[model samples]
Target: MAAPSPRPAGSYGMDASWVPWLWAAIGIVYLVLAGFSVFSWGAPLWVTFLVAVLGLAFLAGGALFWNASAHGKFLVWRELLDELPAPARVLDLGCGRGAVTIMTAEAFPRADVTGVDLWRSIDQSGNSPAAAEANATVNGVSGRTRFVTGDMTALPQFDGGSFDLVTASLAIHNIHSPLGRRSAIGEAWRVLSPGGRLVIVDISKVDEYIVHLRALGAALTVRRAGWRMWWSGPWMATRILIAAKPGASS
Candidate 1:
């Protein structure tokens, strides 16, 4: 068998075009809050009130940015989907813009698919509930797909061992730290049934990926694919890591 070609580098990264507008908005908000602080000078009541409002705004904006980037990465879901099985139950973790969720439904017409995400308007991209619904309908697989808005760390809506496959494409790298990645992996493991499989794709190094999977009690297999290969084999290059839950007789 021919070796899979390596996926293109530099195809991943955040778009910076909106940075100017974002900064401008933040600057304007800061100025408005500063004026409020000046007017409230010695009045402890106004000072505390203004500070709290500004702090909350900042927190909300930060969250919006994070969500936007997460949603934007949904553009790459098609590449990840090629590795999954047909007629399988699929759970898309951090499914922003619902791209993979919809794609999975379409790719496996008999499968039941669910997409879970926080669905912040700013980060939703084309993977929102509405988008997922629309895509599924257009692809003639609406009946098999559902999109839900919720927390990824605690997926209470889903039952344990519910899905045949769990996918977290370009999501693991967005986690804040190593510990956060482990937590997310643990959650993925918890939801997978015995004999279920997981595929996680991120910009992370293979070693880091292995460590995280090991921590979650998963075995790992990595491969790459993309366009412009030697053409003796698979042209698509990707870093694919496949893991199965322990206790399977296979």
Candidate 2:
């Protein structure tokens, strides 16, 4: 097998690259229709104007999404991780291609990071355990990083309170079912050591996660994930959640 390319600093594969591609494709179609209406069909002025505006808007949105996926998202995660104390053990849920996993390793130099994911391509293009492993290699965290093909809702390989820090980024929403997502959050909470921290960034079902964690007796605080985490626009923006498990660390 060929060797993995060394991913450069600040260089990471796209997260849901298809989302932006779909946006750009739709924008192109709209622009084409607008051109056809203006030149060949002599369609209504308002119709042409509307389509043209939509085309430009969609294209702009697509560019933003692409930028955010490639660069902005990592910057945001790095910034978020920087504010916390160094963790000795970290668990990254749904660590597609190791963006957050590698970030955690870099953020906490002494930490041993483990990533778990189902590696579905629909969730992230080129998603695979090997891809995640290669990313860790290229990012110079291979020695301290590992990837496992597993579902977040049920992490059988790990014991409860196994990690000092748990993180999920743009991953939990993929569960599709509310109960399943809640279970995943419960699992994250389960694997956290006492006084350990759980940080999640997701675009959907934020309220459900917060409520579930609150019910579990976690001290929860949440806020907007900011524009860098916006998948397409503000309407689809992600949020960051920080939950602290009770009791002191052993």
**Which candidate number would show the highest lDDT if scored against the true structure?**
2
Summarize candidate 1's per-residue lDDT along 1-250 as a digit string, tens digits: 9953222121222323254346446746765666666675554666756765665565544444433343323434555566555636889887765556666775677789888876554333334567556666765676887888877677777888888889876556656677766667778888888878887765444457688778777877776533211111132123557888786532
Q: Per-residue lDDT for 1-250 in model 2, tens only?
A: 9953222353346777788989999999999999999999999999999999999989988988987787677777877988888889999999888888988898788999999989888878888888878778877899999998898999989999999999998889989899899999999999999999999988878999999999999998899978876777898888889999998952
Q: Give candidate 2's whole-model lDDT.
A: 0.87
Question: Candidate 2: where are CA atoms >4 Å away?
Answer: 1-12
lDDT of 2 at 101: 91
* Weakest 10 consecutive residues of candidate 2 by summed lDDT: 3-12
Q: Alpha carbon lDDT of residue 84, candidate 2?
A: 82
What C-alpha RMSD separates each model from the true structure?
A: 12.8, 4.3
Each candidate's lDDT (Cα)?
A: 0.62, 0.87
